[model samples]
Target: MSSPLKRSLSTTGRSISPPPLQRKIPRLTEHVSSTREPSVDQLRIFSWNVNGVGPLLQKQLSFSADSLSPLRTFLKRHHWPQFLCLQEVKISSKDTATQRRLQAAANQSAAGDEPSYTIEFSLPRDKYNATGFGGKVHGVATLIRDDFGSRLRATRRPDWDLEGRVLVHELDMGLVVINGYWVNGTSNPYRDPETGQVVGTRHDHKLRFHQWMLDEALRLERSGLHVILIGDMNIARARIDGHPNLRTSPVQHVKNRADFNAKFFTYENGLSAVDVFRHKHGNRQKYTYHPRGRNWGESCDRVDLIVVSRSLVDPLDAVAETDILDNALDRGHSDHVPLWVALDMSIFSAKAAQSGSD
Candidate 1:
C-alpha cells in the first residue's frame, strides 16, 4: 500500500502522488560506520531519490538541530559512501532562508568544528520552473565527503541546468560524475503563457533534456574524462529493466527509448559509457523503484543507474559491486530505493594517466 505522504508524479504516463505543500528539508551528517567499510582504494558512490529530505530526516520547518536524522543514521548503518547523490529533493531555491538553515545545520557535527560533507544543490529557478505554493518542485543534490571535496569541481549546462535537475562534478582522476534527475513527461496539458492557450505536454522538454545529457557525457569523454553518469534517468532502456512490462506510448515512449539507445547505450553505436549495473548484473530481475500501492513485480523499474566509461573498468574494480538497496523500500522511506556502485579508484593509475596524457 502507498504511504499517506505519497506525492503524485507521473512516470510512463502513469500518475503517482504529488508532493506535500510544505515539509522540513534537513541537511545530512555522518558517523563512524556500524557496518563493514569499503577499503581505502574502493570508491563507493550512492544515489537515492529521497522524495523529500524532510520526511526522511524526520525534521520539521521549525529547524531543530536533531542529531539522529534518519538519513544520518542510514549513512552510518551502510558505512558512509565517498559520494552521495540525491534526486527529487523538491526544495525551492527561492527559499533562501530555509537553505541557510540547512547549511548552518550541515556545518555542525559532534565535535562542533569540523564539517562532515561538502554539499552542492541544483534547484529550480523561480523565473521559469515548476513551482507550487511552496516553491520549486524538483531538485538534485550531491554530497562529497569533506576530505575528498577539495578534489572536486562542479559544472552544469545552462540550457537544462536551470531546473536544478543536472549537476556535473569533475574529479582530478579524469572522472566526471553527472548526477541528474531526468524529466518525466507528465502528459498533462498546460496553458501556454505567451499564447494563452492550452498546449502540448512536457514531452518535448523531456526529450531535449535527455539529448543534452547525452551530448554532455559524450563531450566529456572526448575531452579524456572517464564519465560516470548516475541518477533517476526515468528511461527504462529495455524490457528487462522493468518488471511485468514497460508502459508504452507508440509515438513518444518508443522514440524516447530508441533515442536513449542510439545516444547512450553501446548496442546502437552510441557513446562508450555503458550501463555499469547491467554490465555487471545482466538480465537480473531487480529494480530501483517500486510505486506505492503496487506489488513489487507488478510495475517496478530499474530507472536508477550508474553508467561508466569502459576505460574505467579493470580486474581489480571490475565494478566490485552494484546493488539496488531494498533497505529504503523496507523502511518505506521513498517509492524509489537507493542504488550503489563500488569501483576501485586505482583504475586511474600511472598507466591510465600516461595514456590520457598521450
Candidate 2:
C-alpha cells in the first residue's frame, strides 16, 4: 500500500478526499504455519469477467485513457475481497489520463480506504499473441492481496502456446488455482454445395484452449499440487432442460461446435471431475452468459465453473456456492458475474481433527 494521503479541512474533521488507489500490495507481518490450517477468515476470493475493463471504466468514470482506479475502486468497494482474480482484462498501462481515471474509480471504490490487492499481470511478449474483444486486450490477471502474493511463488502457464488465456497460481495454502478462459468459437457461415445449407461456428479454437488448460491442471496435479480449477469454462456441465439428444447432441448436428461441458471440455487434455459451484445449497447456478438486449429471448446455460482435483472433489462438494453474480451490473459492473464458494477445510485439512481431535 502507498503512503496515506494528507487530510483536508472539511465540515467534519475527517479528510474529504479519498486516498489514491494503491498499486502496490502491503507487506505481511506474519505467515501462516504450513503445518496448521490457514486462517480462513483472512482468505477471501473474487473473480469476474470485466468485458475489456478499460472501456467499461472509461464510460462510467469519464476516463479518456484506460485507468486502474475503477478497477481498484470496484475491489475496494466490494469490501476488498482478499484473493482477487479477473478475466477479460486489458494490457495497456500507458494512458495517464485514463490512468488517473482508473485511480479515481479506485478512490471512489475505496472511499478513502485501503485496498488489499498487490496487482500482477502476465502479458503477451509478442503483441501478435494478444487477443482482443472489440479492439481491447482480452487477458487474465491475479490480484493476490499482499500476503497471498508474497507468500505464494508465482508461475504462469506458457503465454504463447495459450489461446491468450492463463491461470494456475500456486498458493502458499498448499493449493493451486486453475484460472482460465476457454476459447470462444464463433464464425459466420454461408449455405454451401455439399448440403446446400447454412451454419454458424462453434468453439473450434476453444477446444484447443481447454485441452491446454487441462494439461496444465494435470501437470500441477503430477507435481503434487492440490488444485482448484476455477473460471469461465465456456461450457455447460450438463444437458439443459431441453436439448435434442442431451449428452450426445453435439456429435453430429454441430460439426465443429464443442460441448465445452465437463464430459468433453478436455478428454486427452487432463481434467474430468469439475466441481461446479454445485447445486448443494439447492441448485448450481444456471446461465453464465447473457447478451445485454437478448435476456428474455435467449435460453440460458452454466458456463463459468469450478473444477477441483479429485483429491479435493468430495471436500469442495461440501462447501461450494456457484451462481451468476446477480449484482453483476451493480457490484461487478461486469458482464460475467462471479461464482463463489465456501469450503469447510475442517473436512479436508490436517488441523481438522488435531485442533479438536486433541
Candidate 3:
C-alpha cells in the first residue's frame, strides 16, 4: 500500500580482497589519495578450496608487513570483489615462517588492474577442538578492494575461531557476509566401533551438520538482518532440496537419526536444503562434489554452494544454477569443484513476500 522505503542496499559478495585472495599474499599498496565512493551494485565474489595455505607460506611466503609475490599478483589481478572468502588457509601464527612462503606464491601471480585490494585472513587463535562432530581448525580470510575498504569496511566475527570452519565478514557493502566450509565427511565416522559393521558414517554426519546448519540458520532468521550463507555445506542438495529421493542411502547419524529436527533446522519437501549459485546462462549440471576417481565419480550429488536466507531468495526472485569448474590446476582444490555465481537480490524481497502469503 505504501511505497517501499529506499535504504542503502549493500551488494554482498567478496572482493578477491577477501581473505582467500589475501592469505594467498595480499599485496600492501601505498595508500592511494582520493575522495570517491565505492561501487555497490554489480558486485563480484569468488569461493575456492586452497587445500591448505600453511604449506605455501613455509616456502617463499613471508609473514612480515612487506608484500609478497604470486599471492599479491593473484589478488591484484583478481581483486575485483568488494570482499573475498577463502577456505583451508592453514592458519598459523602472525610470525610463522609459512607467511614468507605464501608471499612467494602471491608475488608470482599479481597482475591486472586490481591493486586496490587490501587482504586479511581468519587464522585460528586457539587449539582446534575436534572433540565435536567435526574436526578442528582451518583458515578463512577476507579481502577488501581499496575502494570497498576505504568506502566500505570488513571484519571477522569473534565467535568463528571455535569452529574455524566459517568466516563472517561484515562488508561496507552493507550485508553481513558469512563465508563458510562445512566439514567434509562425517565426524561420527566408522561403523559402530564395537559392532564391527560398516555403519553409515556419512549419514550420521549429515544429522550432526544439519542440526548445526539449522541452528546457524535460525540465528540468522532471528536477527532479521540481510544475510548470505555461502560455502561448502557438505550435504548433497540433490538428495535434500526441492526434489524427492527415490532411494535413501541406508545411513543415519549414530547420535541423532532424524536430521530434520524441525525444532532446529528448516527443510523443503522432507529434506534439509539450501539454494546454490544463480543461473542466467543455463547449463547447470546435477553434480557439485566429486570423487578422487574420474570415471564414475560422485555425479549424483550437489554439495558446494552460495546459499542465502530463504527470506532473501523469496524477495530477490533469485534463480539458482551450478557450474563444475574441474581442471588439472584444481586437482587439489578440495574434493569439490568451484561453483560459479550470479544473483539479483534487488528483485528478491518483493517476490519473497508475495510467495509467503500464498
Cα RMSDs, all models: 5.1, 14.0, 13.2
Residue-level lDDT of model 2, residues 1-358, one tens digit each, is 0002211112111111111122222221234111122345434456665554454343333432333345664564455555556665554433335434434544343433464455454433333333233223445666666544665777566753433457667765567775666554333232222354553332344455556666676777788766776666655555551112222333421332343444334555446554545534345335444433234214344556666776655543444333445432432334455655444444445544555588
Model 2 / residue 188 / CA error / Å: 7.3
Clash pairs detected, candidate 1: 2-293, 7-17, 7-18, 8-16, 8-17, 8-18, 9-16
Q: Which 10-residue window in model 3 sums to the lowest lDDT?
A: 1-10
lDDT of each residue in 1-358, candidate 1, tens digit only? 1123222322435443455334343232343224366877777898987676656544322334556445554555566687888888777877666555444444433344433766688887634345553664678888777877776775554564666788888987778888888877656554443454666666766777777887887788889788888988877888887666765654577677777777786544567566887777777778877775565555677778888877777423446777777533322456777788887766667656778799
Q: Which candidate is the best by TM-score?
A: 1
Better of 2 and 3 by lDDT: 2
Model 1 residue 257 lDDT?
Answer: 76
Give the number of the best model, judged by lDDT: 1
| Stretches of candidate 1 exceeding 4 Å from the true structure | 1-16, 20-36, 59-66, 100-115, 126-129, 155-157, 189-200, 267-269, 295-298, 314-318, 328-331, 352-358
TM-scores, all models, native as reference: 0.81, 0.64, 0.58
Q: In candidate 2, which residue ranges exceed 4 Å CA deviation?
A: 1-42, 55-73, 92-113, 124-135, 159-163, 187-202, 241-259, 262-270, 279-285, 295-299, 315-322, 327-333, 344-358
TM-score of 3: 0.58
> How displaced is residue 237 in candidate 1, in Å?
1.7
Give per-residue CA lDDT, model 3, range 66-182, as digits (tens). Answer: 344433433443434455566656555453445445444544434464444555665544332322212224556555556656534445544533445666665433355677766
TM-score ranking from best candidate downward: 1, 2, 3
